[model samples]
Structure formats: structure tokens, C-alpha cells
Target: MRWRARVKQLLLVGIGTAIGFNGVAVAVAPGRMQTAYGIDDPTPDLTVLLRHRAVMLALIGAVVVVSAWRPPLRPTARVVAAVSMTSFVLFAFGTGVNAAQQRVAIADMVLLVALATATALPDEPRPAARP
Candidate 1:
């Protein structure tokens, strides 16, 4: 049981790191859009939107990472991560993604599985209630 909980925490942290890094990359280099999503010659308006999105992802990733060590935050963090990944996967498929986007969708699918696994394992036991 202890081992299982440790594994779950590790998985959550790893997943969070991946997500956070991706956001950081985009935030630092908006040009990553060209390689990551195959967007060519994005307008200034699009760049603004992309940067905003990067910030959102960063926030979500931070929550997931922090939740690993803060049991109280796990549920909300899990829900947020799920919604973010699921929406991207559904949207990419529903609208027909290019190769680059398809790769991202695939990665999200894998992350979803990892998320499910982490969710399945029990976290730390709560303290006993006061009399």
C-alpha cells in the first residue's frame, strides 16, 4: 500500500512536469507553435491567444504537481487535468488534426491513462475526526 501511494505520487509529478514544461516552452518561445502545432505565420492576435493558453496550461500543471504533496487538492487537480486533456483530445479528433496535432492528441491520451492510474490508487488516509 505504501509503495502504491508512492508510485501514484511519482506518476502525478511526472505528468505534471511534462505539462508544465510544454507550457514553459511555449511561453518562452511562441515560435514553438510552428513546430508543435504546425502553425505557420501566426498573426499578432493569434500569438496573444497562444501565449494566454500557455499560461493556463502552466497553472493547471502547477496544481497537479502541488497536489501530489497536498492531499486536500487532489480531487480538484485531477478534475482540472482531466478536463484539459480530454477536451484537447476530443477537439483534435473531432476537427481533424494534422500530424503534429495528432501527436499531441496521442500524448494526451497516454497522459489520461497515467492520470487514471494515479486516481485509482488511494492517497494518504485522513486523520481521525475530533470527538
Candidate 2:
């Protein structure tokens, strides 16, 4: 309804859809890390990296959820969202998913963009004034 409400929604969805879902997918989905980039890892580095990414994203998700619930930290939330977005963008670039098979990467990119969009909402204001 309101712009502030919309911004909150954006943050939650971006975090849940992006970090929460993606983190779980990366952590437990069989061969997700390896298959995400279509690579053949001889030492399971991707798996370890994927797990690490999952933990980082889980923490990020907690931050997002907390910010969404409280609304007083919207600016910091926005900053976190932006950083999260950047991380996935970097992943997209680093993984080098082909143009044709970049759907997952693109989905992540969408989440980041959504976060950026919420951050840009004029109604959101500074974090202290939000709640």
C-alpha cells in the first residue's frame, strides 16, 4: 500500500528469496556448488565454498528479517541489501554461467536489484525515522 510498506516487503523478499533460499540451496542441494558453475571439482572446494556462502547468507538473512520486522534500521538494512546484492553479482560474474543458462544467476541478480529498488524508495527515509 504505502511506499514504506513496499520497501519493507522488498527487503524481506529480497532476503528470503535471495539469501535465505539461495543459501539453503547452496548448502544442502546435492552438487549445487559444483553444478552451479558446471565445473568438475577434484577437491570439493566448491562444496566448502558453498557451505561458507550459506552461513554468510544465513547471517545476512537474519539481518534482513530483523530489519524488516523492526523498520528502524531500514537504511542499514538497505546497505546490507546492497552488499548482499553485490555478492551475488560477483558470484554471477565469477561463476561465468553461460548466457543461455544464467537463470539462477539472473534470479539472484533480480533480488539484488529489488533490494536496490527498496533502498531507493524516497518514503523509506533514514533508518532512525523508519520505526
**Predicted candidate 1 versus true structure: per-residue lDDT over 1-131, tens digit per residue:** 68987998899898888777778788889999988787888899999998888889888899999999998899999999999999999999999978998998999899999999999998867679999
**Residue 89 shift from truth in candidate 2, angstroms:** 2.0
Candidate 1 C-alpha error for residue 94, in Å: 0.3
Candidate 2's C-alpha lDDT? 0.65
- Point to the candidate with the largest TM-score: 1
C-alpha lDDT of all candidate models, in order = 0.89, 0.65
- Extract clashing residue pairs from model 2: none
Please give the lDDT score for candidate 1.
Answer: 0.89
* Poorest lDDT segment (10 consecutive residues) of candidate 1: 18-27
